[model samples]
Target chain A: MASTDINSTVETVFRIEQARLIAGLTRMLRDVGLAEELAQDALVTALSEWPASGVPDNPGAWLLAVAKRRAIDRLRRAKMQERKHAEIGRDLDEDRGDDVERRDAALDDDIGDDLLNLIFIACHPVLSPEARAALTLRLIAGLTISEIARAFLSTEPTIAQRITRAKKVLQESGVAYEAPRGEARVLRLASVLEVIYLIFNEGYAATAGDDLVRADLCGEARRLGRILIGVAPDEPEAFGLLALMEIQASRLKARVGADGEAIPLPEQNRAQWDRLLIRRGLEALARAEALGGADGAYALQAAIAACHAHTGRAEDTDWAHIARLYDRLGQIVPSPVIELNRAVAHSMAFGPEAGLALLAPLETEATLRGYLPLYAAKGDFLFRAGRYAEARAAFDKAAGLSRNTAERNFLLKRAAACGPARPVMR
Target chain B: MRVMVMVKATKDSEQGVMPSTELLEAMGKYNEELVKAGIMLSGDGLKPSSQGKRIAFDGPKRSVIDGPFAETRELVAGYWIWEVRDMAEAVEWAKRCPNPMPGPSELEIRPFYEMADFGEAATPEIAERFDRLREDAKKR
Candidate 1:
């Protein structure tokens, strides 16, 4: 192979194996930062040797073996240094020997558990959300500092420091290199899922950035979700989360216009939706439901997305079914946003009056005070009800509250559609 | 993006020779890795071409041909649909796959055409027509 080809090949192999190697090493060494360093050391070794010998048959195992040997060497050197400084070095020798024996045993243990433990540690709730995302992408996804920075639209140095501080915090906190069990396991898994969804949302709809959709972030989140489901196969919520991401990702291409303007769901061209992803998502949703997680938070949302996906056109949507889902979803996790959605669903399923009745109570909601979607829904309902003056006022209010340039323009267009009011005929 | 990875047929495969136990085991492990990485959407190995039939159309004329077809190398023994970040990632994963057959073998990766690829041609009317066709086919 040419030099450049060999370099890229080695890099690809490294990317594939780095996560497992680091996870296994972290379990053995109980230090994530050091484990990552040893994984890199193994990659360097491969780069130097693989070109001469050709790629190994079992490259992943070869990388793991190399990383393990380096880890053992590092431990021995550290032990030797401690022995030199200590007056009572006799006991230390036996301790070192016992440690080596234990490390040897750990080598034969399941790598899946190690990977799961690494995920939990990286996504531990003690870390800040930003830190969790940065660390998880760096460790689990095998993404470099710069790659993560580019994904999140942050400065490279900022991301680097965030990751460094995150590692230091994990070490200082002395988080166990083991997956939690029982109730603790449930909470920790929730934290992991939350981080994954947060990453997906940041990509699906950038809250603060100019780019509305960052496909890379969504892809990473989906990858992470799949990994989570793989390791925790019995967890239905994992399947639910994966299903939700897949279905939502299916619409990514249809969600924007040529100028990158936001295209609301109703207006989006359904042809652009990714059918394969939708199929995968529906299958996953079925799995989640079969696992008796139909009532689960993520599963409920996935069901809603599936409703949209199952329909060929927006007007053909089974809004009554969606409204019932929102009713159930609202019961489980009450939110003003859910109420707003329920209103829109009711509007579609019944008439504009039904939606207006639902939206009336939400007007005093502190959280929904300036929420753009609320007014947008109200204006839509009012316009359909032939209350042009009220619809114009509501749309104007919605347009004023809009953040995205595309969304503001769309709302302004709606407001303008409601022309001057004429006197009512007696 | 998604790609269909086809394991090209060789002489042994065309003759209905089953994979050795070791090869099967290696492929199993490779598939598990793909699933865990959230790449493999669907995959299956096909029986030898002898059991398959093809139809040819020339204007209004229709002709039927039975397999085993000629040009064994062009025939597919198996295929997988994988969702990957890009073609490079797909290629990397494909490179990691075990040799699909005994002796020299080949794998081909072809990306599926995405809806965006159709540009303005993929109108709602066309999409709905395709949807109806799909539903009709499924019903049949």
Candidate 2:
């Protein structure tokens, strides 16, 4: 094989194996940062050797073996520093004699636990949100620094520093390499779910970019959520999150048109909607509810999504049920976003005037002032009520606030459709 | 039983930039829809052509060519391997695929060759080899 082929092949192999290698090594080393370093060392060795000898049949095992060897070497190098080093050093030395089998057994025994624990550790509350995202992507997703930066629209050096500092914080705090139990476990689990969902949300909405969506981020988040469900089968929120994302993700195809214009839910081709994702989402929702998480934030949102999923068209959507679910969601989380959504649902279930009544008061809300969706929702309600002049103004405001080109175009179109401003009858 | 849906590459996809979350979610939902309908076998998006490679064969002389291939319109960005009843069914399913790209995208669906289609061309030896190959594939 040529050098370029070998390089990319090695890269693909490393991408696939790095997470598992690090997960297993973390069990042996008890330090995520050190294990990652050792894994990198193995990758380096593969780049140098695989070209000469060709790729191995079991490349993952080969990389793990090399990483383990590096771990043993490091333990010997740091022998005099701590009793912890001495104990791990002795363990590594014994394991090396029966290397492949023992290593495989160790991997089989705690692979799931180790991966789940690593996720919690990466998302430990001690770190900042940015750091948690970078660390989680690096460890679990096996994304390169540049890849993470590109995905998040940040620079590589910035992401690199965030990851480096995050690892330092984990080591300095002496965080355990196992999932915490009791209330602490619940809190950590929430943080883990938050980080993954945040990643998915960013990809879905793209807060600042010109584009309306980022499929890669959503894909990564869904993949991570699925992994979490596999590793923590009993966690209802894990199921809830997967269900929520699945239902939301299912609509990605019909969200925009050929001209890159935003297609509102009512305008989207319901026939184009992914029924498989809807089914999986509904199944997940059932699982979450069966596990007694029906009132959970993600589960509630999933229930809301299910309302849309069950409909054959926008008109068939159970808006009243959705409004009730949003009410429950508001009681639990109490955000303006939820209120706005509830208002929209009320408008659909009740009347445009009712929705407008709720939205009118929110105009004075500090949080709603700069929120684009608020104005957009208001515009929709007004348009439905035949308050064209007001609707046009609301849509104009929405267009001004939006960063996405497609969304701005759609909003502007809505504003234009409202037609010439009418003179006041008074 | 199977068809391949090839999503032609666009300038944006060729550049390695990411798609927005909205599109991803929509496609994810669409994929779920396909799966729920029992029409989808498997699907995936591909990295840009710069990360790809091709091999040209001239009678036993094979040559490797790294990608960033010039024909953006002709290049494939991603594909879906689907299981459907027939070519018409495959085309119907293709019609339901999301735009895939923000501006404009195209999906070309082609039926896979079935052993039954070969008929008299399928000698006993060839059939046995095909059976062995399918069995081997299942092991993986």
Candidate 3:
């Protein structure tokens, strides 16, 4: 193969293997920082050698073997350091000996705990939310620092530092390599789900990109959600999360118009929805409900999604039922966003004035003062109520606040369409 | 095992317009049929031309062109990644697809490359690695 072809193939292969390689090495080394470095070393070796000798027959195994060897070298170096410390009459931590034994036992079996632990650690509460997201994508998604930065629309250096600081914080804190136990387990699991959901939301509605969706990030998050379910089969919230994502992802294909402008849910063609995904989502929701998790936060969201997924046409949606679900969801995890969504549901279920009444109190709420969607929602309700000039002003405010080019243009178009004459509701 | 089913773009698609509710429901039902029959792995619709971009390369130099491309007929409005028994099966399923646009539209089926097509170069060992990778992927 040509050099460029070989390099590209190797890059693809590396992405597939890097997570496993790092996870395995972390099991042996008991250090996420060292494990990542060893994985990168293996990648560097592959880049330098593969072009000359052609790609290996079992490149993943080859990379794994190479990374394991690096682990052995590191163990030797650590042992030497310990010996020197002893010779100098300096005392090392008592846990050092036990760590070696645990690591040796880890090297003997194929277990998935390393990855599960890594997920928990990446979302550990010590790191900032943004840092946790960046680190999670880097370690679990096998995304490069630059790739993570690009996905989040941040600078590469900023992402690199975020990841570096995350690893440093993890190592310094001496975070355990096993999943948290008891009540802590529940909290950590929630964090893990939050990180994955955040990633998925970024893909589902890219905040600033020209494109309405970023399928790569969505696919990554879905894969991670499935893995979470596999690892934590008894966690009903995991199923709830998977259900919510699957149903939302099912609509991704139908969410955009031909010219790439964001199409409102009611305007999208229902036929374009992915039925398989919807089925999987419903099944997951059923699993969650079976586990008596119907009232859980994610399950509640999934219930809302079910309202949309079950309807064949937008007009046929059970608006009153959805409005009730939203009311319950708002009570459970009350936030400005949920309230905004609930307002939309109320408008659909009752009338535009009812929705506008709900929205009026939220206008001055500190948390949503600059939230573009709030204004956009208000604009829709006003336009439907035949308050044209007011709708135009709301749309203009929404247009000004939006960062996404397509969304901004769409809002501007709405602003322009707010003429004196009222259009008939469909 | 896999084929891409492309939805041909029309004038309305180029204009960044949305399909009607009736059309959306018809398409949704058709997609449900495909999903129920286990023919579709995944599918999605595309935004209009104005939201897309193309990169043309000349040697190492590349230039990016903003879309709203002039060629409406050549553009793709949507697509499905389908798994069918054969090309005949894929074609049969395509025939049952609902009209995705208000005006006449086209659906084209194209097969994906299989590992067997690589012949000698796709050694058993190489295939094994891919299988291992796929298995590992599930854990991520």
| DockQ scores of the candidates | 0.33, 0.02, 0.03
Best by TM-score: 1
Q: Summarize candidate 1's per-residue lDDT along B1-140 as a digit string, tens digits.
A: 77999999999999999999999999999999999987788899999999999999999999999999999999999999987767777888998899989979999999988645866666667656645644553454
Worst ten-residue run, lDDT, model 3 chain A? A87-96
- Ranked by DockQ, the better of candidates 2 and 3 is 3
DockQ sort, best first? 1, 3, 2
**Model 3 Cα lDDT, one tens digit per residue, A54-93:** 7686676788777766666666666756755353222212
lDDT per residue for candidate 2 within A144-210, as digits (tens), equals: 8987888787888999999999999999998877657778888999999999998998788653223
lDDT of 2 by residue, B17-111 (tens): 68889989988887875654334646788999999999999998999999889989999999887754346556555665668898787888878
lDDT of 1 at A37: 91
**On a 0 to 1 TM-score scale, where does candidate 2 land against the true structure?**
0.70
> For model 1, how does the per-residue alpha-carbon lDDT over A236-332 read when each residue is reduced to its tens digit?
9999999999999998877765555666777677777888889989999999999999999899999999999999867678999999999999999
Instruction: Kindly report which residue stretches of model 3 are placed more than 4 angstroms away from their true locations once superposed.
Output: A1-10, A45-62, A78-112, A207-215, A379-426, B1-140
Model 1 residue runs over 4 Å out of place are A80-112, A206-213, A421-426, B55-64, B86-88, B113-140
Error of 1 at A90 (Å): 18
Docking class of 2: incorrect
**Each prediction's whole-model lDDT (CA):** 0.84, 0.80, 0.78
